[model samples]
Target: MNKQETHHHKGIEIFGKKTELYFAVLCGLFLVIGFLIATFTALPFWFSLSCYLISYFFGGYFISIEAFQKIIKGGFDIDFLMIAAAAGAAYIGSWAEGALLLFLFSLGHALEHYAMNRAKKSIKALGELSPKIALLKKDGKLTEIPITNLKINDIIAVKPNTKIAADGVIIKGSSSLNQAPITGESMPVDKTYIEDIDNLPAFNDIDKKHIVYTGTINGDSSLDVLVLKLSKDSTVSRLIKMVSEIETQKSPTQRITKKFEKYYVPIVIVSVFLLCFTYLIIDENFEQSIYRAITVLVAASPCALAISTPSAVLSGIARAAQKGVLIKGGKALESLGEITTIAFDKTGTLTEGKPKLTNVIPLHNFDEKELVQLILEIESLSNHPLAKAIVKDIKSQYKILVTNKASNVNAIQGKGIEATYQQEKVFIGNIKLMESAEILVDEVTISKMKALLEKGHTVMLIGLKNKIIGLISVMDLPRKMAADTLKRLKEIGIKRMIMLTGDHQNVGDAIAKQIGLTEAKGNLLPEDKVNAIKVLLKRDGKIAMVGDGVNDAPAMALSTVSIAMGAAGSDVALEAADVALMSDKIENLPFVIGLSRASKTIIKQNIFISLAVVFLLVPATIFGLTNIGLAVAFHEGSTIVVVLNALRLLRFKTK
Candidate 1:
């Protein structure tokens, strides 16, 4: 569809969803007029009857259609029970009471649906959130063009306080951004122009300090952002698709409630049928017996219980999406709340995923500057993370020309890279690579490397032919927010937080200590990580694995709940994850877990409220303690309370 047509269709769809609320209001208005006329006005009896008839027509229209649809499909639901009860009331000459029952029932539906709309506000608003037009900056001039016309590498000029036009990196200016519309980040994140794009992560869309997302507002600086994604693939578009599927994926509680409704509705209908005739034996007054039977049906119907879990789950999913968390489904969210242990992949989950060169020691008459120059020429051809770090370190310290003289460079998995530079073989790797090549390192340099290794630095050997020339050490530090996030997780009752890494044992332990993880296991390959997860599974009630790369995908798949950093994780990690933190910030992890727990609590409370009302009213209704009108009032009132309670998730916040 064209953009205008798509908007027209959305408008109609939204308007159609509100029809139930409109009809319910009309039903209530007519019901009130009928009651006032019958109780106080000295009007003709038919006048009140007419108002009651109109109320019945307005209230019963939607219910009758739904009830008949179920019956036609050889099934039954709460709608069928409610329609039957209303008909039974009218059959016994209580037209006003029948109209009251349908009125309140429809009103409850309207209000429950309204609660659902409040939950869906995030998705509906997302469709219109991103700007349709962008100020395209091309060849030193700005032209306003439709976003659909934008392409990759296109630069869009964003003025101060304007919504970002596309997902891109700042190339020319610095600014702070209000990412609340996308990331739920309350503070403005600073963005600086990126000068070295090649240093970015190889296999993922890992967000950089200069990365800008669609729909976020730019602060008080004009920025030229180089577009990275098309309009259809923006963050806002992904959220729309994610949140739209919320209702289709049922939670465990919602699924169970549906099963209960299926059998419960049929049983109530049968019991009400038997009770009407059974009462004939005690009291020949058929009027009183039938009245009691209809009341029992209305009271026993699972109105509030039918909607209890779904409403809560929907609200929970919508609110989570608003806060930059995309829970795959209600089942995932419900299970994540119960996780007793969490496994963090050390590289990206706890650490910043970037290693920095900390020490450079030249040995055996090797010049340090020439060593750096040779290292840069050799490392520049490789995409290994360590190689990138080395190149980044060299460029940051000294300017150099890209001679591209290094040739035939190849990475040796688990060790490092080997190449031909200046017509001589240069080997840049760990001790394993040098030892296998029969290269000799002096005792003094070996002791220095050991000292660096003991201090959690990754030691690499620089060898020229059979002699070790020098060694450089690098370290990947834990994220700035990792310690604080772990503290919050502990306060919220996470019993165990372990780190699984592919680094050396000492390196993992040192990083784990900084992040406060309960345990640190290192020297793990992908399969070894899976085995560790298997071990964790046997000991914990439930476990969650947090990862952000292809290596972590296997372990993540084995966990009870898999969480991936959506913006930073490899595609495999995203596919395997049950939940995704789109913001790529570890700080948001606790919020999602806390939200899941709160949702579960709300679902339980709603189920209890719904059941308690039914249990209390059913006996009272049968014994003559309450009439049809009173039973209907309390029954529908609980449904409204249940829905309103679920809506509380929309405003859920951490202390």
Candidate 2:
């Protein structure tokens, strides 16, 4: 459909639902008017009866239609039980009681719909974040076009203070962007074309330099952005789709409740029949017996039980989304709550993925400046994390000295780089790489490397023509919040936390100790990480693996629950992970765990309250303790109670 037609259809649908709610409210007002008239005024009997009948038709007509529809489909539902009870009340000549029951039932239905829609509002708001039209740059002139017409590589101009229309990389201009909508980050992130285009590791909002996503607001400077994704495939669009799918997935408790409902309705109907038969044998009054039977049906309709889990799950999902944690579904949410052990990858998960140039030690009388110059010439061609750190550091310090380029630079997997610079063979890597090159490291250099490794620095040997020349140390620093996050997880009942990495054991242990983790295992390949996760699962039963989502995909897939850290940019990670943290904040991990535990607790509480209400009210209604109107009140009241209780999750805070 065209946009206009699609919007028209949506408007009609929204109008229809609102009209239904309004009609329900109107029916309630008429029922109250009829009650007050009958009780207070000396109205004629036929006139009062006419008012009550009008109220009943207005209030009960839709419910009766729905009940009959279910019956025709060979099914039973709450609507069927409610309509039957209302009909029984009217049959017993209790006009006011019947009218009140239908009014309360219709009102409750409207309110329940309102509450559910409220819970889904955050997801719906995602659709509204992106603008409908974008400013396309054509022939050096800005032209407004629908975002749907924008394609990959199209250059779009974003004016200051305007919402970006699509996900794109900045090719020109510099600005700060507020990405709060996508990442829930509070501060405005600075963006520039020069630095970001060169260092664009991945398209994440947290990385916040080159990429501007749909729905983010640009600050104070015009930017020309090259579109990287179509409008529908943008971050906001995918998030909306994810949340919509999540809403359709039922939690374990909800699934069981659904099964319970199918049988519960039939059993309630049979029990009502038996209750009526017994009352008839005892009282010998058919009307009074039927009245008691209808009350029993109303009191045991299972409305509260039907609503219990979904209300809490929906609320929890919405709350988590607001906090920048995207839980795929209720199943994942439940599994996260039961996590006993969490395995963390070293780089990009616990530590900042970026490494820094820390120490440089020279050997064989090589000048430090010339060594840095040769290292930069060799490392400039490689894209390894350490290479980038070295290149960045050299460019900042010895930019003038970097006059020559390396020839035939080849990176050895898991080792380092080899190249020829200035008619001399050069190799820069770990001691293993030096050993592979048949370069001998003396005792003094080996001791220095050990000390650097012990201090959590990754040391690389600089070898020139089969002789050890110097050593460079780079450290991937822990994230500022990593220590506090680990401590908080411990506070909240996580007993086992381990750091798994491919780095050396000394380096891993040092990083782990800094981050408050006692168990650290290093020198693990990707497959070895998977094996470690398996071992953890065997010992802890329920383990969660958290990583940057690329190299750790296998291990994450093997764990009980998989979390992707800083996944807002990586499509593979987002798809592979059960839960994704949009920003690079490790502190959110504890919040997610805390939220999952709270949601599970709320789900159990809702179920208990619902079942408890049924257990208490059904017996009261079957005996002479409660009447039909009182039974309906308590039944509907319990449903509202459960819904309101679940809604409390919307206000959940990690603190």
Candidate 3:
């Protein structure tokens, strides 16, 4: 279809959704006119009858359509029961009563559709965030191209105050990017471009991986971003697909209630037929018997029960997404609320995952400045985490440049590294390297190394041949929010919080103490972490494992709930985890758990309200206490209340 024709079709679809409400309102208007003519005006009987007939036509429009469609498929629902009851009432000349019944039922349906569509908008809006057209830069010329036409390594110009069209790194220019849509981060992250073309500043790995995600806003300064991912493979696109699938996953209560409804609908129809037969034997008045039966059938149709759980489940999932938490399904969300033990991985989950140069002590005639220069020169050739820390730290501290850097360096598998500096042999590693190389270390220096280890520092020795020259300490600091987040988890009802890591036991103990964890166990391999979870599972009620790498994936899979730090998470870990904290903020953990608990409470309340209405109306209709109009009003009212209760989750906020 052409653009104008497509718009016309879209307009029709939008109006069709609102037509049910309009027809119901018109039905109520005619019902009032018919009632006034009979009770307050001296009008002809046919005039009132004509008004009621039009009211029924308008009220039954959607209901009749739905009932026939279901019948053609050899199935039935509340719509079928409603249409039969209303037609029977009108057949008995109770035109006003039947018209009122359809009006309320149709209005109930219109309201339900409105509420659900509003809830779905939370996730649907994610697809609209990226710009359809990107300003592509090719051969020094700017061209406007569709985002789908963009290719990997293609450069795009993102202007100030506009959303990025693709995921990329900055090759030229710089800006602060607001990544809230993708990461849920509160502050704007500053990004800079490094144009050494590709080979400069190899030691600073952070800049090499500096990236901007699609749908994030650029600040005042414009940026020239080198595209790293195609539009369809962008992070925002993946999130949209994940959330859309999450909406289809059923909760435990939803499964049970839905299964009950499947068999319940047919049983209700048969039971209504049996009740009418029994009533005819008791009373010779056929009109009253059938009237009572129709009222009871309308009352027990289970409209509210059919919708209570799914509505809450969908709304709960959408609410979590709003806060940047992608819960895979209602099952994971509910399981997180029941957790008693939470095991955290040290790297990237609890700590910063980046080591820092903490201390440097010189010995045997070497000054601190000369020792730092040697360390920087030798580590610049390596890409290890500790080496990067040393290089970064040295560059920030001194401006010394050696005319001849280290040469012929080779790493010893489980020990240290060996190289030639200024025509003399040099070494860097743990004390084992010293023992293997026959280097001498006095008792006083050995005691100092033990003290640094006790303080959670990884101690390394630097020396020339058989003489120790210095002791350097490297440590990975805990995140600033870790202490507060752990304290809050304790205040909330979690019984045990543990730390599991591949670092030494002393390092784990030190970090655990600073973060207020109940216990810390270190030196765990991938399979060992899985075994730890297996042990925790046999003792604890429910447990969660939080991590950000593939090493943590095995243990996460073995836990009651697996949570991944999405911002830095490996693809395997993100897929294996049941929940993704997209912002990598552990503070949101308590909020999501609280949301699940609240969702559970709402689900129970809805079930009770729906079942209570049925129990009340079925018994009352069996006697002479109610009519079709009153029963319809009570039944439809319960459905409206149940839906509105579920919609409350959309506005739920973290405390």
Candidate 4:
């Protein structure tokens, strides 16, 4: 069974496991017994009515009291409307009709309340997925404690196959980390024992020996991590803050709807009073027109209209959350559905941010294995991402030994690293470093490097004695879900998807083509992306920009909607984004788009149905066709119908 049905069943179970059903049967039995006593035993009409009244009170006392309370609060809403209509029917001497209206309205309300509560419960489910406790280490011993109790500089141990309790650095041990829950990037990053000091200079490098963030999962090894931040200090905490902020932004349509309802209800009531008095003045048999006044009031209540839009929006949010997509609120969901085009940042959005060795070019007649060994020996001392990849590549290929006394090893900011290996100058960096060393790259070798760079590969040159010996080309790959998701977007009527990157045009085009992107631009800075989006907006197209690079922030802010890839810990990009992906799975983009569209469709249907009820009911009542029992039925029916329509969002699925 679905969540609503399940929740309804539990509520029914709590009230004697079948209390409503049993009570309904008991009321039916009492009606039959009272009818027999009145007809066959010659009982008084008042005594028979008393028996039926007892049945109604036992079954519907709560609804009657609630309706009365709502009336005193000056909010004569659906409950009060139902009670008034039913009492009016009784005043006209139709007791059975009034009692039946009360029973049906109560049952309809019970079902509607269950549906709405279930949907709200589903939306709040994501906040519960994170673990509450973390194992903190004090005085070399592990202590289990609540995540909220974590403080800065507190060291904690996290094991493989468990969620990281807070945001901090990895102090000890080597393992891969799943960062999808925070950054929306879908990949595992290899982390090592020694902290990369240059990458985290703001915090004391001494304390950042091992750190792990909240919401990431520990990979195949256990490690000790010092909690740098807890709860509100963590990335998830910031995401919650952003989401709450987005929810606070009022939607223009929702505002107008509220204002319309505020004046609409009172005016409708006043008009009904005028209609009743005018009818009484025109005819001497004006008591017959009382039904007309009750009918007009029943038709005019805006309960269905008021509940129509928000109920669907809230239900859609709940549905999106069920699929692991946390859309902040109605405004975000509405904006996301309206996007016409999408712009994507290459690194960490379209392509994997991590660079890997794709090709190795050997110079002269040197042995490839010997050149690789020399490169690994020189690179093993550095902890740059490129350096680590080179070391990993060397370790995977062959076992090699390097002198422990290698000296004068210093890293050049944004250039490369240099070291003296075997008392000879060893240089490894990009093509710029090769020129600075006065190393003349031959035409043939230069042509090969350019070809790789054209294909979006970053080239690292290995030089000795100011002569180029070999080059290692590292290229970023497309994510696993990129192509399939783009195809789905195309299927769903998204006209175009573009990849914007700072890499060479060839590289951007290569990955874009691989991921089904028809439009691709390369070597564009953050400003270029912003201008591109602005130009697109000038043509009246709504755009969604997705990125995980710090440079992509301005463009993200400029787009119609910003989606940030956070799995790689792109905090700056995420902070600038309108929507944060808790999972790196690109497939959710299409899933969420489908969800928004589905919700809009449901909301539109609800509006039409609600308005149709008012139009149909009011006309029928004017012609004296709608009775008190039928009026209450239609009133409660529209409320329940709109509610059910809104709750359909909870069952929404991507596939």
Candidate 5:
């Protein structure tokens, strides 16, 4: 059958819906009439024969067509086995049984379609959320056009609450935009017009003045943006492409399973054929031999087992995605269930990784406010993360409006910032910077800094006119949910949780203790992280690694299951990970682990049930204790049972 001809638009195809209803009605009527008549009527086998003819034409015709197609393609699929079994049942004077098989088979096909349609709803939702049109500007006049038709360098206008159609910059207006869908960020961002265009990257920074990407929502204020890229060039496009690549690259187990089936199928076929031939030779009856052959074929078909694992895994993946967790595939799902140890990247994974003022120590009479204000003055001249922390703290502390361009300002790489503030040379940096500037950081101040550092704070020294005036410590602090998540994991049989970081040991240790973890390793480069994971695995524990930054990609690749913290993690990190947490809630960790374990269990149960029925029922039918009708019924029944077993994955939850 041509797929296109049968394909129907989801919401608008009236004919397709009516046809489906018609088929369903016919199936229900035929089954009810046949079963009731066979049980209640005193009519001969002729009555059963009439009911079978009506039912077979209604459902069996489709199966026969599909089976013939498979034969022509040189593929001996379950479809062929099913039709043959149904046809053989009719030949041996078992009319009602063959009709029953057709009815059940049709029901299974409908259920399969329902599952597929449900799964595709996610992609459809994503598609519908994207904006369809954009306002394009040309020759100083703007015209509204479909977003797909807009090209590079075209300027567009975006209203509040409207989705951004393409990746571009802000040229004419400034607003706080919500980029949650694109970046997994929870909050809106304030984007302003670029003042220094020359400082920006020259390559593909289309319209350095204004840019917006597809799927990003504009803020309350309406703004004009330039279209730098179409859908295919946007960030989401790149992510989609990466995901496609990941899907196409099959797991090691999947490749091995395919090879196993390649050899397994032929051997099963040969064995079944020989068994049938031998039975026929001994019995010397053509009909008996053919019945045995049909029984053997039905038993040999691995539909139940074949569909079991993939269905459960696929359902689990869909469930995870709906709950803001993105797991790649079955291989990843399997690995997650077996993880005994989890290695976490420190900075963003554990800590908030954003500056919060922790402690301030004054040498003389200066208070926290004065020291922070002076530090902010020097920090405002630089764009380093530590510098931003000081500036942020000053605003929070005193509402000071520090100058953007500091006078007599000097920033030393890997050191601190020095600037003239209120006619005095104020310095803010690490201990080495103060020492290099000949500013004496007294032993008492050093001890105070060490005390704060030991408590998971980064210490920055502040000086006035070359004299050390105060000690300032800022800490990123652990996420509020981390402790609860860690405790829950321990209770759930995860023995150890380890922290890996590129930061100093002091910071890592403080966080580990606060979060109730005893194991902490710091100062690890990206490569060192991978080596550490290998070492952790050598201890005979299945490992899971969680990270968010670009640097964490290598470690993610090395773990048994890598879960990326999607809320703040880089695209590279997300792509490298097998599982991803859509939100920043670490509490979801236990939930994902539980879901994986449940899915695996269901898959195992399905395989066992399928194999048990095949091994037990097929032989009974072969020995003349059961007929072809019983064999077909068992075969189709086993397939339905396995499918329903796999559907249990959809109910898995992690709260």
Candidate 6:
């Protein structure tokens, strides 16, 4: 089948399995038929009884069988209590009332199941993003093949508007790509071979412009990509895998409910026995006492309590995922609500991570245009972040064609470039590189470089023939939303916000001031970042560390919570982070925190509602204030109310 057809079939398969709703409707139909036959029609007693029996079995059969199995295993649960209550009603000659209890109980189960499945639709929709087939390039020809057959290093062709079938790097062509499926970014990212290939500093570095991922739509231009990862290991595939595993990692509240179940069932059974004995001694009537005991069992079943946490957590997760925030599990969601402090990595977290040319200072009577042209020519040959920024700026502002560009260009590690431009030897690097070359930089120029550095600009010294000519300053500007996001976080009770960076202390402090951060620790090595996170952990409340996810992995792992920003394109970031922000926008941070706090509130409310119902109803049943029918109505009513309350999270708006 074609990809569209396959997706259609999968959707149909999921909707076809909604058996609980159908079964509940069927049971309700039989109960109505039985009541009408007994009350209105002149039907025989056997016929009416058979209709009631059908309704009872249709609604109560699975419940009774589950209860029986638990009893066989020397266990009792809410199901067993429900079965006992229904059986007691039947014993008291209230067959219609027994059928009603079973019907309502089954209806509650079906509604809860339907609501939870509805919340899971967002995760299930992820499966539809990946295409089933790929356009494989073999021996310079394109052939259609299943995506599953594609392997690492395989070349693939993605046409305009078609979905990319694997994670790969661009070998040829350029296009604007819609990466919303993978990254949740609302904007279409521009990609081109010229910029990526020319400015790439290292082969292993992630060229955001050149890399395309599975499930993302290619723009109006075609692209030839070298597959770096197979279909199974692609970003979208791992996202689906992670979302599928969320249910297995239960929240603390869920674990407590499970433990509470172990003793709760037995306690209810004992309470039933004690109530029956005490009532019989007081009333001296066996039938009335037994009925009251059954009412107490139904009233204290803990159905709403059992569903309270999972329902709220599941809804919260679904809502967050819809907004491009992938919370791994309920534990992470709950932990987010408790985070008191947040730490951010400078580059890629608070800043855009894309440096731009801010200033170009020429020295020694050097022509500014000539120096810019020479720097551009040299930088165009390299792919470092700073080089890319300089080349981009020079190209946009000046028309410099390096037709016969520099030759024997060598990239000096941790410094800059060495090349022979126009037959004159030239060097471009930092002060360290200048010192190594024995170039004389006047104290005036040195002060200028220091002044630029203090303003958070990275300075690159340009030298020609062993003489310092000029210097270019580049800086990665802070993201526009960084300050606003920090303000929102503080408004919501975050105690401290700190920035950690590998840049110099002056640069870090300057950027921190721009972004409203109170403290910043700069010149931090990877290990130093980890030590900072450890020390922060020893202080007051939970700390969350946010970063690009690659270099910050160690420190993030040490923090209470790890968040990865712009994780759609980086597999390393996704793997290292506990929570992945699919897009680059920092504003989503406050939304996630708010959703978590709201979920916690709903969980507490649901638990209180459930427990209060039991506490109030159990005493009423004991004191002859409630009967079997009223107890069943109130008990099932609470379950429905709690489920509906949890469902409110599905409509939660982050904005």
Off-target runs (Cα >4 Å) in candidate 1 are 1-259, 282-284, 354-358, 363-370, 381-385, 397-427, 432-439, 450-458, 464-469, 474-477, 500-510, 521-535, 549-558, 570-576
Clashes of each: 0, 0, 0, 20, 12, 3
**What would the C-alpha RMSD of candidate 4 be, to one decimal place?**
10.2
**Each model's TM-score?**
0.61, 0.60, 0.62, 0.61, 0.64, 0.65
User: RMSD to native for every prediction?
Assistant: 12.9, 11.9, 11.9, 10.2, 9.5, 10.3
Candidate 2 yields a Cα-based lDDT of 0.73
The candidate, 3 or 5, that scores higher on TM-score is 5
Per-residue alpha-carbon lDDT of candidate 3 for residues 419-467, written as tens digits (9 for 90 to 100): 8887888889888888888898888789999998997888889978579
**lDDT per residue, candidate 4, 1-655, as tens digits?**
0012123331333365445545545555565665566668876788778866765654455445554554576644445555565556556655554555555455434433332232233224334435799899999899999988889878788887799888777777666665544433232445655445345544434342244557677765788876777676575565444344433344466566446645655566666676676564666356657667766666655446646766787788778777666665454566778876888877777766776667777887767987877777778787555667767766776666654645677665435778888889888887777788888777977888888777667777888887888888777788888898899999987888888776667887778767889789876644466678788777756788888755565566667677876575365565556566767767788878888888888778888987888888887876778775686678668868988999988998877
**Per-residue error (Å), model 6, residue 325:** 3.0
Quick one: best lDDT, which candidate? 1
How many clashing pairs does model 2 include? Answer: 0
lDDT (Cα, 0-100) at 54 in candidate 4: 63
Model 1 has an lDDT value of: 0.77
Off by over 4 Å in 3: 1-267, 284-291, 383-385, 397-404, 454-456, 525-527
CA lDDT scores, all candidates in order: 0.77, 0.73, 0.74, 0.66, 0.68, 0.73
Tens digit of lDDT per residue, candidate 2, span 154-182? 99999989999999888888776766445
Better structure of 3 and 4 per lDDT: 3
Q: Of 3 and 4, which scores higher on TM-score? A: 3
lDDT of 1 by residue, 76-161 (tens): 87777767877776776667667766776776555444433322443455567689899999888999999989998898999988
What's the lDDT for candidate 6?
A: 0.73
